[model samples]
Target chain A: METKKKKPRYDFILILILAVAGLGILAFAFLTGGGGASVEVSVDGRIIAVYPLSDNREEVINTPEGKNRLEIKDGRVRVTDADCPDKLCVNQGWISMKGQSVICLPHKLTVKITGEEAPESKGADIVVK
Target chain B: MKDNKGKNNIRQKQYIRSVTSHGMLVAMAIVLSWLEAQIPAFFAVPGMKLGITNIVVVTALYKMSSPSAMGINILRIILVSFMFGGPSAMIYSLSGGMLSTLIMILLKKIRHFSITAVSIAGGVFHNIGQVAAAAVILNTDGIFWYLSVLWFTGMVTGTLIGILSSQLVKRLPDSLFSLRSGGTK
Candidate 1:
């Protein structure tokens, strides 16, 4: 005679809570819209360079793995070329909006657009006081 | 002496059955992962996936031991990565799969939440693990921005897999899982 409390069944409430939370965050992200005027280039999570979107320029980034060519033209940025196998970064096209970004997974490079000024910290008031 | 031998024989049979069943579950997980990869993603997010393969892991966890589920999940990641993606894919998948499985097993042990909640947590952790791996490989914290978006997607996909696995658990025969538990008739 096995005696163990029957495993609790699926909780719809939990699922609903998760769904609401996920959707809420997504909605917030969408509503924020892309409004940046500059693109920030990062490698391995650290900002390596920043370029104004109004400028037209090209940069070749070299790392231990390989090189990736980034081009900023007409207020948009993109990975024009890369030595990575899949070339998915080059295929990602241009990003010109505040939140738009292009990432090269193979090279661990990311180019993300940002507003002219950094957004205020989410908990700035609480932390500062 | 006769009773001991009989018991040993039963144990041997159970072991063989467990091996075969676990093998089958691993195969199922691999195929599911591969199939999901073939489908064009609805979203533009690079790593976002339907996570259909998780259904097998969840089902295995419910039906067998956590170790068995972990083994099956890991094997599926390796096999599917080899078949569909290359080495980079393998690294991401291994990191994400291991983290997700660990989270799911821990949640299962807690028993406070339902299977759906466990799966949801697994999904969230899986994305976090992958993002973390990508950040390490790329050496950039910029990738963290993807976390919120990925978490949202994870929740959606995890809920889907949870619902599916729940239905599957209900339909599957007890005999399918009885070998490991030693409930053979």
Candidate 2:
């Protein structure tokens, strides 16, 4: 039979690419810890506020955006309500671990996990740069 | 004219298949959506909840078409909202779901990409989509700030869903169509 040169089908390409993307995502997740370090957001090393995942329940964290309610109901910390526009920080569910942070750009307040320390920064100072 | 007519017939047949398949997808999306809601948010941020919805959305995107996934997601949202959650969850789900669907679909088509990349892309897009949705729904641009937070979470969660989906696809081949085939896209 005279054969026609078949065109390349992209269905498999989509699956392979999705699989790779999944791998990349897996790498990032495994590398980063979901169990974030407990951090106190502050200005100039002086922790103006603190959010401990173990705190159990919503606590008012004083940020640049006035008094916003932050909670640790499940296994992470999240801003329940913020005066800041967009309320994005409030929408972000939970944060627990390295490289994870909750930011309120409009309010200039950032709650982030710097690292796992010996609780020095806990009682010391946390300055926002 | 004869050749053109033949091509038209083929195109029509393909369209019919797509439409019917999409309907089935919507039904499956509904089931998945319900299942998604039942998954207790592993971590609860008051006014927010988390689950494996992203994985299903990403998996569907990988296995099916973009519009098909989108349709399923939309149906899932409506059904789940009706079955559980209030109008609030629906708002966030719509924004995040649509974004995840669009981004994953694009990344899946990217050259030399992997499911890992698609998963991460899904994570990032899910955040962007939700933040955008928040800004629109809340009518405030400040929502973008939460993007950083969501980004990290997305990376973490999306990867998990991706891995799970990958494993699932391996165990369940395409033709088996009878196994829990409540697929949306």
Q: Which candidate has the highest lDDT of all?
A: 1
Candidate 1: deviation at residue A108, Å?
Answer: 4.0
Residue range with the least summed lDDT across 10 consecutive positions in model 2 chain B = B176-185
Over the stretch B58-164, how does candidate 2's per-residue lDDT look in tens digits?
A: 55665565666677787878778777765756787788877778777776666345566576667667766766765564443223334544566666666677788
Lowest lDDT 10-residue stretch of candidate 1 chain B? B138-147
Q: Which stretches of candidate 2 lie over 4 Å from their true place?
A: A1-129, B1-28, B39-51, B139-145, B176-185
State the lDDT of candidate 1 residue by residue for B65-125, as single tens digits: 8999899998888888778787888999999999999999997887777777888888988
Q: What is the DockQ of candidate 2?
A: 0.06
Chain B TM, cand. 1: 0.93
lDDT of 2 at A34: 47
For model 1, residues A1-86, the per-residue Cα lDDT tens digits are: 22147865555666676667666755665556456687777766666667667778887877567898988899888889899875
